[model samples]
Target: MTLLEVEGLRVKIRTEGGEVTIVDGVDYAVEPGQVFGVAGESGSGKTISVLALLRLLPRGATTSGRALYGGRDLLRLSGRALRRVRGRELAMVFQDPLTSLHPMMTIGRQLSEHVRIHEGLSRRAALARASELLAEVRIPDPKRALEAFPHQFSGGMRQRVAIAGALATRPKLLIADEPTTALDVTVQAGILRLLDRLRRESGLSVILITHDLGVMSSIADHVSVFYAGRIVESGPPPELLSAPRHPYTRALLDALPHPEAEGRGELQAIRGLPPSPRNRPPGCAFHPRCAYATEASLEQVPLLRPVGERRLLACHVDPFAPGP
Candidate 1:
């Protein structure tokens, strides 16, 4: 079943000078037990898009879009309605646990608080449930861990606790925003595996947001590559990663380090920096950095065109067209 759907999502932030668009015309869907990956560089609006879904944008930011979850429009929900849906129906695992978790509150109290609010369970019952959740996330000796504070746990354990809290309500959709950014490779793999197992066992839908193509390739069923404020290309993992069509997507994949080519020479990185939101390119946002950019690409914007069964490319030149 389709657990969450977002279409024509546009987000704008108000600055001293004027309003600037950060996310433009983005679209995607997530079904039960599916993992959808949103990949892009730092300023590609990946995190902003997820924040917009929960109505968690800054004071000066405004969002317009249709975010349908369980037959309800999230964008239209207000006050109490949105609150009820946030931690119960759709939960989020933020990038950093230290900043996300309450430093002063004990881990046990933090976990129990959500259960009490969302489930309305008694303090005793909530504590029991909290311990169970901690165990579920593989935190050793849940009893002792609960008594400790955020600083007491290692980076990985703290992240696991954050994940545990997100799953406390057994939300239908989980949005993990760069959940593994601060962890090492081994810990990152463990966390990914744990999330994958939880999704399969509980049939929860997930949106994994990150800039690492390797991480997405391992977990996501469908991948969307974002540039500036728009989706440049989207398709199944094998197709998008192996045979990317858009110049920006190709450049991103080429930038990935290959062990085989390491000894030959230095790696080739994409030239130029990403365009600023305050001053985006006129036509294709990536034209300034794209190697295959032509006059046509610089003169007109390209819409996402159907390329394959489940593939779409937003580029002026059709890379798969008949040869010259």
Candidate 2:
């Protein structure tokens, strides 16, 4: 079932000079019990796009779009209505656990407050739910752990607590923004496994936002590749990794260091910095650095189009046949 559908989602900030568009005409949808991954490099608008949907953009930022969830437009919800929907029907795990968690509040207090406000549970019942949630996230001695503060747990454990709190109300959808970015590799793996397991057990749909393709591919059933303020391509991992149809998509895949090519050459990297929001290049934003750019590409923006079932691409130059 389609749980969320976002269309023509655009964001612009009132800058010193003028309004600078951050994300432009980005669209995607998430299904129930499916893991939909949004992947890109830093400043690719991956984070902002999701943030805009939740009406979490900074003050003075404007968002125009339709985010249909449960027969309502989430973008049009009032503050109180949105709050009612946010943690109860939908939840989010932010990028930094340290910053997202309240250092002053006890873990138990934080988690219980989340439940009491959303579920209308009594203090004792909410505390019991918090303990159960901590256990579900596999925190060692969950009951004892609840009494400790956020700082007492390691980075990975803190994230687990965040995840547990998000899941406390049994939300239908969870948005995880760079959940593993701050952890060590081993800890990152554990968190990934934990998310996958939770989805399996609860039938919870997820939208995981990250710049790491490897991380997304490991857990996401489908992936959307975002470029400067837009999605350049999207598909299943096998279709995209095997035969990407856009120049930018191909370049991103070629840049990965494969174990088969460990002794072949130095790791490839995409040259040129991402465009500044205020001064993006005209036409295709990537045309300046694209290997197959042409005069046509320099003058026209390619709209995202389907090349196959469940696959999309946006590039003037074809992967198999470069434009003249």
Q: What C-alpha lDDT, on a 0 to 100 scale, does residue 28 get in candidate 2?
A: 88
lDDT of 1 by residue, 1-78 (tens): 788889999999999989999998898888889999999999999999999999999999989989998889998899
Q: List the residue pairs that clash in candidate 1.
A: none
User: For model 1, how big is the CA root-mean-square deviation?
Assistant: 1.5
Per-residue lDDT of 55 in model 2: 84
Model 2, runs deviating above 4 Å: 321-324
| Location of the lowest summed lDDT over 10 successive residues in candidate 1 | 315-324
Error of 1 at 218 (Å): 0.8
TM-score of each: 0.97, 0.96
What's the lDDT for residue 92 in model 2? 91
Off-target runs (Cα >4 Å) in candidate 1 are: 260-265, 320-324
